[model samples]
Target: MWNVPSLEEKEPELVREVEWFRLYTWTHFSPSDTCRTYGSGVVQPFNGSAFYVRSNCAFILTHFTHNRVEYDITIRRGDNGLLSEVEIIINKVRTVLQNGSILVEKKSVSLPYDHTYQHVFRYGIYTRFKSSLLPLTVTWHDVPGGIDTLWVELEKEQNSDITGLCGKFNAEAEPKCPGDLVYQDKGPAYVPSCSNPNPRFIDQENTSSCVCPDGKVLNDRADGFHCVTVSSCSCVFNGRTYLTGETRSTRCQSCLCKDGRWHCSENSCPPRCLIEGEFVTTFDGKQFAVPENVLVFWQSSMYVQVQTSFGMKIQVQVFPEIQLYITPPRNHSGVISGLCGNNNDDTTDDFTTSSGIIESSAKLFALSWSLGACSENIPNPCINTDNALKCPKNQEFSYNLLACNHTCRSLSGPDPRCNLQDAPVEGCGCPEGTHLNQENNCTPRSECECHHHGGATPPGPVVIDGQQW
Candidate 1:
């Protein structure tokens, strides 16, 4: 049978095995049993003897050096005035534990490296690892009680090479509490963070508090608190978080969140205009109806002119009334201007004059854009009070005279003149039984005007040069 090691024989080995040790326990008690509190403590071997120190405040729990490797451990309190976070730094790498989560450099990561050994216990996880520069095995147990237990087991040759809260290994000294207790009924300590970098503290109290490593900031996230450089932090917008290099777009602009701010650029949106019936919507989005009876008169001496350009025809009339009609092409949009208004879809500045001032009065605005001098006094032709010049007794007043008074004089088959219809003007026209003749009089269809070679003649016998024909 194999012989097992006896309890007495293993006692001395177990006592000398661990160079330093610490165990944090929950000390806060609640009478109502409605709130939870956390606590902290430390235990280490000093001069071949073990001692313990306990506290409920946040402070630098321990800072020691062993075999040229530095280890720093700190306890931090939360907003609830209870110990909540634990920070550990070995060499330059930092790790934090808060709210049952582990964070390394502001990001959650799996515990127990490839070289580290891990074990799961009934209460928590236990991890152990030994770095090349450190001549001791470092072990820590994550407990459910909001505190952790740490142990440093040294090699036999490195027994007297340790210093700090564990005590100077070469001297026999009594364990003492750290003088730097922090957050004893005090306000919070504001440090640099992703959301609030370069924080300015007011009424700073003389106390020790845990901070992120050099050149890093605290990133308080939904999961837990993290320590990271400013450049690696995500941006928060509209109550949502966006990673670096993410982008968003709107109707007029495109934006990206970078370096904790929004960078935006205007979008290139072409404008459009709408002119429907009496209502005109400009390129700048101003909407209004054209005023009634405000007529713009071109000089009567100017002959009729037709110009074809931009896939559309422009017809200028200067006979009974000065009128202009432009039939724009399907693709002709956003580039036209003048009396019709800029077709750029924005109506706010449609009445801009040649002098660059936007005029408010439509009549004055139209006058400002006229190329030639207009008659100072112009009469409204539609307001004819003379009953003799009005429609015949049998006729009725029609708003759309083009359809109601179409006669042989007005019908020129397949001609451009037939397509050039006038705008609807208030006028008198013949009723169903009669049509307007070339003599400017209403008559029955049997005595209507006659058309020969697109020329119109009155229905009665005509006398030309005093000869009856």
Candidate 2:
């Protein structure tokens, strides 16, 4: 019976004693050919993602392709550390011809098992244009079931490792029969018709049986009838026991022991500089409301991270010394490098301004903005404030300085135009036709005309007489 576990069941925790194996595939094809495996390790028999599998190591020189490729490989074990049998199933969307020949299918041939019960099979595809030479390197491992965690890899095969392993058996053997015929009184041979894919003796011969070669023994457990040598099966690292596919976690990295080597990856660590809440005090001792999603973190050695809502982020790293390194947000792809400096009107000792501008020493360029500023007040460049606007009496214009989409510096002073030099220039504007272009300059009721020949231009005073327009 074919044994497959139910998918609804929760996977059990992996033990430390069971051995595991890793199976990786490499493929390459394109203007630049490369080899990469679709998945890794001996667990998880299904791969929903599509990827190519190369024959031999020549990635760029192949023309075959397979679709809907999936693998179902299982290894069964018996008593006394013996591998009872190995079963493999590779089902994919394949095309067949009218003559009834399989094309674009995985062709595999099983081989003898070693002392550790490791079975190696050479597998590839059969297509109309080409049939891959027998013996593609596919390994089947014996591991405890119900544990799932795997990673894929990209690699290339060099030095013809695939062809080098062709025709090699798991154990060495020799024929026990001598060259000379021992008995010649044999019955007459008869031909037999064959119609099934089954093994049969070519001709009956009276001869001695074969035995294990030198320095080898007939391993009774391995397939019950195979020759193999002995080797160590235990592996230990850092005072902890590790099996073939089991993984371990350190402070900054995670590692998995495969075969005998360890593969590790760095973990994502926390940042050095951190800011929380919706309000941040600037270097000038001003408190302003920021967005809720603004987060700043330290990245790499010299760079700081400013991540905003959505997928937007600004990387801030120090320049050689005097300036800052601020890469444009990835979400806003076309934005160019910007300035980072203090607000000229801000009298803060720290170079970082209230508006998130980092003033440079030479005032040549602004490097980066703060996370708070990037989210709430980017492009506007000025710190937003809440203040009541006071126009002269008789002017009687209802205006709130805070409603101007910008900022107001001082609430108790005239010309409170929010003139932070490094910030974007923004000021108060009066109602239509009543000019309030400058601070405290609210002019009204003015008309001018200009004319060169037959046409008169309104809104200014310019004429063929060449007066100021």
Best by TM-score: 1
Candidate 1: stretches off by over 4 Å: 1-42, 46-52, 56-69, 75-83, 115-125, 156-161, 169-469
| lDDT (CA) per prediction | 0.48, 0.30
Candidate 2, superposed: residue stretches over 4 Å from native? 1-126, 129-232, 236-303, 306-469
Supply the TM-score for candidate 1.
Answer: 0.24
How many angstroms is residue 450 displaced in model 1 relative to the true structure, after the best TM-score fit? 99
lDDT of 2 by residue, 211-237 (tens): 334433333222222334322112356
lDDT of 1: 0.48
Q: Compared with the true structure, what per-residue lDDT tens digits does model 1 show for residues 212-290?
A: 6677666643233456777777777657888778987745567787766677795554553433222345664465555
